[model samples]
Target: MSYQLTHPSLQHDRRILLSITKWLLIVGVSQAVQIRLSASERKRLRKIARGHRSPVREKLRAQIVGDAARGLPNTVIAHRCGVVEDTVRKWRGRFAADRLEGLKDLPRSGRPPSFTPVQVVEVKALACQIPADADVPLARWSCPELARHVVAAGVVESISTSTLRRWLTADAIKPWQYRSWIFPRDPDFAAKAGRVLDLYAGIWEGESLGVDEYVISSDEKTSIQARCRCHPSLPPGTARMMRINHDYERGGVLAYLAAYDIEGARVFGRCEPSTGIEPFMALVEQVMTQEPYVSAKRVFWVVDNGSSHRGKKAIERLTKRFSNAVMVHTPVHASWLNQIEIYFSVVQRKVVTPNDFTDLAEVEDRLLTFENRYNATARPFRWKFTRNDLDDLLTRIDRHQAAEPALTEAA
Candidate 1:
């Protein structure tokens, strides 16, 4: 089917070229070998010849047929279509003998597969095994290594790295790459994490938050250092990137305590000497003294199990200072649940990255300036994961953990 071309004028030059080729062929007065074509067949062949995405060989065949149908000699067709006269003759004769069916290449038996299905399975299973278990003394498997191992094991007598790569790619198996993770180790992980998630969803103790109440995700980023470059940094230009000196003098390091009001879209922070009960309390005091929070009915603070806000003592210390405040700790090693860590990540990218500060003062100034700039545009983060998602996560982890030992024994 023909489309309404966006730029019909664009096709005018191509039309002119084809017309000129035809006209030059007609005036030469050489006897042409004619191939008759019905109107529908002629239109179909022209469409195929003009199609932008058509295969090169298929388009060439269509052009040869279309020109032959128009009574052009084999030499003219060959010259304009960029083929030898013998190439044009073959297609023209085939079209004359069998019409459109002759344009297709006849099927031929391809090379036999070098590996059978069972052998492929054996190779893949070997790939999934630890290199130490295979006694190959490698940290992971590469295509070449896998090929050699499989050949030595008689899974295949000989195999190429490319063949192994192709089979692995088709199944999306990459034995060379790995990622680090942890299974939830805390016995009360689900219950503890669920409470933090509830606060994120504006729920605590199974009730919606009140208008005067708030949720705060708080944490400390420790050991942020100020590195004074030995030389002035160079700016990026054409075909180059910004360069900074690797050698530097350490000005000092400090802890940054930050608290993000989850539903309020506000951030309160301060540079501390270090992270401890005292510095964290100072941060709590800074937030508690603010106008809305000072008068807030209840403020729930979500934090991870850091030394500053770890156990019952930290909770008792915080609540004793601010009567309206409530302390909630995320499960051990689970910083992902703390929304303040999200703000910390943003600071890591925008403020602390490259870290070419002259001194700790410059670092502190940059951080405080960024906090104000960030709050101007910050909105409440859309946190959708709930206790139900936590349940699904734990269930999946349980199934995977349960299967691991059995899988090992079976192996």
Candidate 2:
């Protein structure tokens, strides 16, 4: 009996079978006549397979060269190794032509040296010394000035200011005045810092207030002179140059101790002839007793590591009087950690910079007015870099590994 070619499932099976058969035929023929390896290719394969070391690189070289020498084409080797065929061909050609030296990287060409290592050290030492010791005319030694000094000292043969800057950057040598910083290595540093952060973070959210004292964030502008507004006096025929004798004495310079409360969003400032512990304590008392009560059930004060602040008798006396008074001191040289410094910066920009009043009372009045305005709209500060950030950063390096080799530094 003859079978009919009309069954749908049988037709589908026949088409799939034809495709498989065609693919198998092409593979079988292609494998039969692969490319042959040249003599140069065999030498590279032998050397990489035997003498040259570095397990990872050796494995790569061996697989590419050995596969080619075994009569497989570059394309076939690349496909097997999961890389571009051109990469395999390029490696093969280079290894054959130039041997080991060709595989090594070439030195990048650039301008020659202007300063030696010894000379750079001498420059650094000179820069680090006091201006008096250097016998220089300038008050301080800036980078450019230091570069000139190096040339003048006959340390470096000849160098440009730009080249000196480049070397400094490359060497990571910073000569600018830096505040000496010291961290509290106490076991409870993390816990104490966290407590301070938590208190400030949730100051407005709950019943807690932040108390802090800010000294003059700037020096007193003592030499401010008050004079009449400058204008040419008009004659009878011309219009009048309307002017008045500006009040100079009534509004002179005033020194102030600024105390701010985080929850109340208000500042209480006291003007004194100078900033001393007595005025500071008095201001603290006024902040505690006179100001209107904020939402906080208690107040916490955050201060920095200053000598006047660390007076044991004063702190003990204040703490005894106020049941809720707690003082948190930031790590030495870490005053930026305090949020009140940020408030002081704002005061400098808005209140102090615009106009120099003729007398001290004007300075005092301006400070008080600015404090009033700030308190009316101030909001609680949000601090996010928790103790965890610092903890993680400090412990990142693995102690178990051998220390890495020091780099050969350039002048």
Candidate 3:
């Protein structure tokens, strides 16, 4: 029997076949959207994908492109890389459109800066100056105070302290903090300080020191008080810190004299009721009477300008007592350069801090015991600062001083 062309059953069947074909074409096109990288592109992508230091986003993009180039389907690429299917598809399409440049983040639009550049410069300049120079009563500039002052001075119409703080933080400027420093007032600072630095480096008079010659850094830690706590100290336990009593009884005070061998890492310390010419002389005797030092070709004693050992008279005395001992004094107010001060700081932190001694005798015993303990493992300090560093520092200081006149004139 011949079928009619306009039959309802045939027409319905035709519509169904057309719809199936359309859906199949769509699926084929979607799956055919694949990435094909060139030789150079492939090398770059592989390098980025394998790099441990590549940026996270760049690495992800590179990995996506790499997998896509390997004929991975979008779903498989997403699954393997722990990313969403949409993300994989998006990056794949972007690479196909613009190659590697399309993987970078586009410039974002955010809020404009609240303060103008001029206002920022003014604020920073004020921060660089002392509060006294500005005739303000504040000793230093807090963020809030600085903001208010800038507004009052018409630098900015208005500003928030938090915003000001953010600006200062970006430039690493903190005006509210103070660091203690002193200028080199002694005229012979360079000559004297250079000599000490040279000694630490095993150099003297432009020649390497002899093997038998020794360098010693000596200093006195005075007024160490013994504090007997009213309540017993609590030892640390699970999830608790060691408790030390705030109230303490003053047992007594004493002075500690220590001498450190800059080259050998040896320490000799003595506890005395007080520090003076007499006590310091005894410490010298204790060290000078020992081996190696006793028969050494030369022993350079680096000391600070303390009253106990100061001036030509003290040098004369030390040299007269031990002919091999050469007294070398650090520049005035420059005790921080002394290596013995470093040992004293260690003693303060480890032995004297949070002091809970029962009596003066306990304090002395602890200090002496720690000296021996330190010497057992002690090594010479790695003194890196040399004459070159000193010269550079002084040059910078001179330049800063020379600029003051111009800065004042401009103001």
Per-residue lDDT of 194-266 in model 3, one digit per residue for the tens? 9999998889989999999999999999999999999999999999998999999999999999999988899
Tell me the whole-model lDDT of each prediction, alpha carbons only. 0.90, 0.60, 0.92
List model 1 lDDT by residue over 17-84, tens digit each: 88999888776435444699999888888888899988989999999999888877887888999999
Order of the predicted models by lDDT, top scorer first: 3, 1, 2
Structural similarity to truth (TM-score) of each candidate = 0.79, 0.43, 0.79
Q: How many residue pairs clash in each candidate?
A: 0, 6, 0
Candidate 3: pairs in clash: none
lDDT of 2: 0.60
Clashing pairs in 1: none
Q: Best by lDDT, which number?
A: 3
Candidate 2 regions with alpha-carbon error over 4 angstroms: 1-156, 169-198, 201-255, 263-266, 270-296, 303-321, 328-338, 382-411
Candidate 2, 1-411: lDDT as tens digits: 555566777788889999999898777546543334568756765776676564656667667767755767666888988889777776666555665454444578778855678887777677666666678877666788888788887888677877777767776766655565454555556555566555655542344433432111111222322222233323344565533434323343445666656555566676777655566667667766753432234566676655546546656755776655656665555566676677767867776653445556666777778778877888755556666776774455223122333221311
> Which candidate number has the best TM-score?
3
lDDT of model 1, residue 213 = 92
TM-score of 3: 0.79
Task: List the candidate 1 regions with Cα displacement exceeding 4 Å.
Answer: 1-56, 68-109
Residue 110 shift from truth in candidate 1, angstroms: 3.2
